[model samples]
Target chain A: MAKKETPEVNAGSTADIAFLLLIFFLVSTTMSTDTGLSRMLPPIVPQTDDAPPVKERNVFTVLLNYKNQLLVEGEWCEVSDLREKAKEFIENPLDKPNLPEKSDVEVEFFGTYPVSKGVISLQNDRGSQYQAYLQVQNELQAAYNELRNDLAKRKFNKEFKECSDAEQDAIKKIYPQRISEAEPKNIKK
Target chain B: MAKFRKGNKGGQQKINTSSLPDIVFMLLFFFMVSTSMKEVTLLVKIKSPEATELTKLEKKSLVSYIYIGEPLSSKKYGKEPRIQLNDAFATVDDIESYIMAERESMKEADRPKMTVSIKADADTQMGTITDVKQALRKAQALKISYSARKANK
Candidate 1:
């Protein structure tokens, strides 16, 4: 009997098909990883005076005016000076009488340590630029980060991020991020 | 020259491109692994501020975005700053409902871990951001991030 044979399908166009799909993904998707400053907003509470007020000395007032200038602790200051001033207030290395007070606290995986009671109270005007606000926030954050890194290196012999979870918790307990962003008041521009 | 020319017998042979499909497939697999599918169509012009201390926003599926800036089409939306949620222009009051919708769409177990990322233009006024913050507080989306680019020192 005579035999009939079927020809193979052409695989030459497979490259074109793959190229089309690759181009589609390249055009539709972005190559950026979302990065940012993460924060937790204070929960809404009913109007009440029950909460205890922070001490006058413990509060580090940061004012961002309409002109996007900074006034730290009732003094005209530049953004460069803010980080050092914040670190000083938070660390109180010299135990300055005017700086924020520190209290002893028992931390996990670490012995008794004095934790600062400083709270950075940030207030911005209605017309202040968001970029300026973020800069100020970044500076303040850098201060805490530097302080944490110093403590980690001195005690744990490692950078802040490289420490173990418990060691990190101990460091965080010693130097917590205490920035408080107050609501903007209506200022006539 | 005559001696070298004698080595060539005829026209040059064609290149074997049987491996072309394999090379293309490699490229296709790379993009598929490295790039994520974009979920939102932004309507506002957002150029996020730059900062040194940055935290990478993980779990793209669990994060919803809020864009605040001047509208892309200023003639229609006016020059005033606007907020965009998903693919539409949204008002400050609409933020609550939008958060609720996003929360409802997610699985029950993953709702608590949801983080709202605010991508705002650097030049925008603080008033617009303050309004958004209040709305977020009311919506109970307490965990939020201000989207920014990594700035080198």
Candidate 2:
């Protein structure tokens, strides 16, 4: 019997097949880079019989309702104004009698509580929109960052990010971020 | 002139296609390097809110995503927002175990550096978010990031 010759497969079309697959991925895939607001969740505290009550003066309360209305310290406030309000409350530059109390502990380089010992307490209703909640949170954080930056600038003649580790630590000690987010309350519609 | 004309007629000219495959392969490699496959199929529809104060999550391996939004197939899941962990819809109760599992899967040194990124829809309520946050707190996943788009000026 005569030897049979195997038919040769075509290699010229392989590039076309790869090109099709490449185009499919190029069109369908989204190269999304994730950006976010970084925060640290407070550690869960064990329920004790007697936890000391936080002083009313030490608590800077912010309430957000379902209507996206903001009630800051029992007064209506706009989102745009929250940052300045929070900064004022935290810094208390005027040393108002009703504002947060100054700390007793004093360090050499940093004074005793140029920033207040008060905690910014955020309370939101269950029906409140997440957008509103985040906006408020953003404002609160901005207030802290701005204050810290200002302090860093005054102390070290540098921005917060540009300060040395010890200088940054001192600034943070003076102006610590103390935001307390309360559990969402049920509001009657 | 007659010999030259006869030679040109005897041989048909063809454009060189040897570099075509190389060019195509180069493009393929470029796409392959830039393309990252979708990690988990989204069971919920999420449109993250926009904000000016945004920080990019630098390490992909150090971050785990928790998605919160209404189910895409609303007919089956209803309109209420739900929490999604990885590829499945999870209730608040599932967060502890899910976080523990994720932590266990990582190297011991990397465990402490892990961050939970919550990607929630703009319209979702704060109640769901608070519950998730409580769950994360109990799970000891302290570091958290709320995913949002960069606001346009």
Candidate 3:
């Protein structure tokens, strides 16, 4: 008899094993990417009596009541109209006396350009729904994003995302997103 | 009849499936590479709200998630909304300590770039959310993200 050799393992079941692992990976894997609205919370400030108060015209106040009602700058407005309203408030295209004031700032890419001194203050009632608050926040953010896009398009002839880092910095400096989420107070009435 | 008989005699040859394992292995390798195992087991029922303007969170290691929603077991936990950190249910007070611990555990250089993501349910009241935010502020986790899904057009 010839020398004994090890029996060949069946290859038929190998495909089945790989299929099992593939299925496991397919089920266990979470392919969904994480996305969200990026916001920065103001650092905790010490209680002070002599803090410089912001001017009324310089602050664009957006209030959301518990009923999901929009109270924008002391006027009742709808959510859909917030973007354009906010854009107008930021740009102050006509430089209305009631709107935010602009000061000339020497930017890197662009020479001396006027920058708005506006701070968007968003405050909501404790009883308000999260969905409504987020909607308001989204509208405000959209307003700023639209302005940045338009400026980038005009200055560099490119979209905001396509602009160089320095160009973007200049644009950002010109239209800084300074949304402040204030502490919730008793606004139930 | 003769031609038919001849054709029947020379039936189609069976395909060689010897490389079937190779194909399966290739797919298996692909899935293994692309797979991102879920980081935490969610104890709360969270349905994040939708928003149009979104920034994709980058650098997985730098993100610390804070989940806010009603507990999955509403019977045992009552109907009140809860904050979840990692695997356990936590309170608003626990958030500051949780954030501090998370920051301490990270690399020294990465601590500043760390982002805290608040994944709050759409239906939850703003009261609880406010409390969480206040706690985060005290903890000095200023860079916060409100986790939201992309709004469908």
Candidate 4:
């Protein structure tokens, strides 16, 4: 018999292996979640012996329950109520009789005074729902915007929207204690 | 004799790679057995902020993961921001001390600068998030980042 040459075999098996490995990783890898906001926060100022304590009552308390329910001033209120409440209280500064009779409170000359009514503390109960939490935030922001607009209109005695940026900023900070409180929180027990 | 010599020359030509399948399969098999993929550690949950641009970080730095959420308390203490950094739980105080200590131990050559990759829960309080940011600044580590999933449209 005539000698026969060795036959070649299919080598596509390697390509198949690569394809499988690629597919495996693509399916097996776990995706990461998004971490919110990159804020350039201010330094924490160490308290000095002369430094006055932050006013406790000046804080506005908004509490959230585990059910995501909201309570403003210990009253169960809808998420939409926050903005209106903020606007009503912030703009019409209460006659804070307990506050120092000084014309203005300076940062350098810190003093203890009854917390201004404009300070709002928004608290969420631990059980409060997520959607409710977001709803409350949106309303609070809206309230601040409304307060700003109202202040600008009073300053210009005209349509608030037409007010200059500088004029708006000036009026917004005109009442420094207005809306000076921090954001709402979910306080754990 | 001339025709026979011509046939001999034609038979001497070399074969191309296309004609070889067995050798290619053997190489593929070798690589499959030897190649190993790197394993990545499981990071905490976070809802990254929206950004128009994304950039990768340097490999040499020490990464600290801080989680934003309640400290598993049940009594309801009114509204105060709560946070947990690594194993210790506190309001955001230990953040500065921890980063400072980590910085001190780093080797001169391997000392990577500090940057925090916050992995926060989607339902975490904004106050807690902001508090953590403020703490990082107090720690004097401004090179902070939020871990995010690559967007797939």
Candidate 5:
């Protein structure tokens, strides 16, 4: 009897097989470059009977109603102007008497309590749109960033990102972000 | 001159494709290494809002996502926006346990670095988001990120 011969397997189609698998993965997978607004939530504190009330003048009230309208200090304000408005409120460039203040700590650039006691009180209605809320928050943050950038440019002759850690910390101390978000209020239809 | 003369052959020469598989395999391996598999199939529709100030989340291992939006199949799961933890639709109450479980699963050293990312639709209301925020604060997950796209210039 003749010895049985094993058939030679064809390997010519290996590349084609790999190409098919590669195409499948390429179509199914998405390369998402995730970007976001980083924020740290205030630690939950137990309600105490003796908590002192924040001064009305120290707080820059920003209210968002159900219709996506903005009310800055009880006056209707446009979203486009929010950044400038917030900057004025925080920096109090003219040393306005009504603006927030802490103990005088003279700094190299801006004077003491530039924004230490200035709190942006943000309150939104339950029916307020998320987009509007986020935009408001963005503008508030932009105000702080712009203030810091300006200070960095003045003191170090460089942009905020180029400043050293200590320099950045100094700038931050002069204009720290003090956004306080209040609980959403119920809106009656 | 010698190198130029070497390419002067008139006869038809078929290009070699024997190494094509090697090049393709290299690309396949590259994609496999760089690409992370989609861990959860999205049931809700999320069109994140656009913003100017955006920061990129650096480490994949240290981040967990919390999705909030209306269900794609609105007929089945009402028109209201809902919170989704992983693949399942969840409520604000589920956040505490979910965060605790996620923290427990991580290495002791990495627990402090964990960040919770909220991917909510632009049209979603503030009420739901506020609830999520409160839950996160209560859970001691202080570091939070609101996922958003970069606005076009």
Candidate 6:
């Protein structure tokens, strides 16, 4: 009768090889942050102790609930309204500019006197969550862009909306400041 | 010739087993050496959905990502999860305001140039994620990406 043959494993050497390989991976691999989106950040506010505080109205607040519903100034509104509201508030002060009598206007923040604060307070119901907040944000940006474009057009021609596209572009390039800092009506409470 | 043939007839070839061990070890070593290290999550087990065609984001700036999870509970629904822009949680609902703030504070060199990345739970509703994306778009945030992991692994 033939003897049965048994397979042998080089246990110690195998263990050593595995250990070395594991160590190599540990040392060589780099961890990465799961990232999303690249945005051109707005310029920083000038850092000066003497600079005045931004008025409450100047800061807009848009709130969202857990259900993904949006609330602007505590009143429920569609996400679309954010842009228009932001544009309006940013473009026109809640008060003034309509008075027939010309009077000395002391600008506390910018434009005519500030009144009735317009703030967007976003209150998320633990349920409505992150994505909902993002939706609200997009609407706001669209509003800003529209307002900016409108302002730029107005600056170059004063009658800009009626001017040729090429002419408007020429004017815009010539007077960048007018287009850049057409400071929207200061948001006032 | 007959004697030589007779002697060879009873002889058997011996197979070498040592090479088998070496090959196994080499393969193990190769995989170990080539395997990459993944992110160390906070010990939270989340089962994300799978996609066949995966695109890796080597650069971080291309996406605006937000993570949605139960703030501190096991309940699947009813509970409101915490919200944050990347890592910073804001108390207000004004997402545009926040983006504007971030944009305004950013340097001229870092002008708003980014893609949005959303890393929400698979179990999370699509509406929430959409809303967040919309917000980014409203801020004129053009590029965006979603964060996903290997479905099988």
Return the TM-scores of chain A for each candidate in numbered order.
Answer: 0.94, 0.79, 0.95, 0.52, 0.81, 0.42
Q: TM-score-based ranking, best first?
A: 3, 1, 5, 2, 4, 6
User: After TM-score superposition, what is the CA distance of residue B36 in candidate 3 from its true location, in Å?
Assistant: 1.7
Candidate 6 CAPRI-style tier: incorrect
Q: Tell me the deviation in Å of residue B102 in model 2.
A: 1.2
Q: Where is the poorest 10-residue window by lDDT in model 2 chain A?
A: A106-115
Per-residue lDDT over A1-189 for candidate 5, one digit per residue giving the tens place of the 0 to 100 score: 599989988766878978987887787777886898888888989889998988877899999999999999989999999999898888786777777665466665555533457899999998899999899988988898998899889889999999888788878888878888876788665
Best by lDDT: 3
Q: Which is better, 1 or 6, measured by DockQ?
A: 1
Between prediction 3 and prediction 4, which has the larger TM-score? 3
Where does model 1 sit among the CAPRI classes? Answer: medium
lDDT of residue A4 for candidate 2: 93
lDDT of 3 by residue, B1-153 (tens): 565565445688778887998999999999888778998899999999999999999988899999999999999998798999999999998998999999999999999999999999999999999999999999999999999999998
Q: What would the per-residue lDDT of candidate 4 be over residues A58-96, giving only the tens digit for each residue?
A: 455677667667777667877657777765555545655
Rank the models by DockQ, top first.
3, 5, 1, 2, 6, 4
Judged by whole-model lDDT over C-alpha atoms, candidate 2 comes out at 0.88
Weakest ten-residue segment in model 1 chain A by summed lDDT: A180-189
Once model 2 is optimally superposed onto the true structure by TM-score, how far is the C-alpha of residue A169 displaced, in angstroms?
A: 4.4
lDDT of 1: 0.92
Task: Output the number of the TM-score-best candidate.
Answer: 3
- Alpha-carbon deviation at B79 in model 4, angstroms: 25
Q: Model 5 chain A — which ten-residue stretch has the worst lDDT? A: A107-116
> Could you give the CAPRI-style class of model 5?
medium
| Cα RMSD to the true fold for all candidates | 4.3, 4.6, 3.6, 12.8, 4.8, 15.4
Q: Which ranges of candidate 3 are over 4 A from the true structure? A: A1-4, B1-16
lDDT at B115, model 5: 97
Total backbone collisions for each predicted model: 0, 0, 0, 29, 0, 63
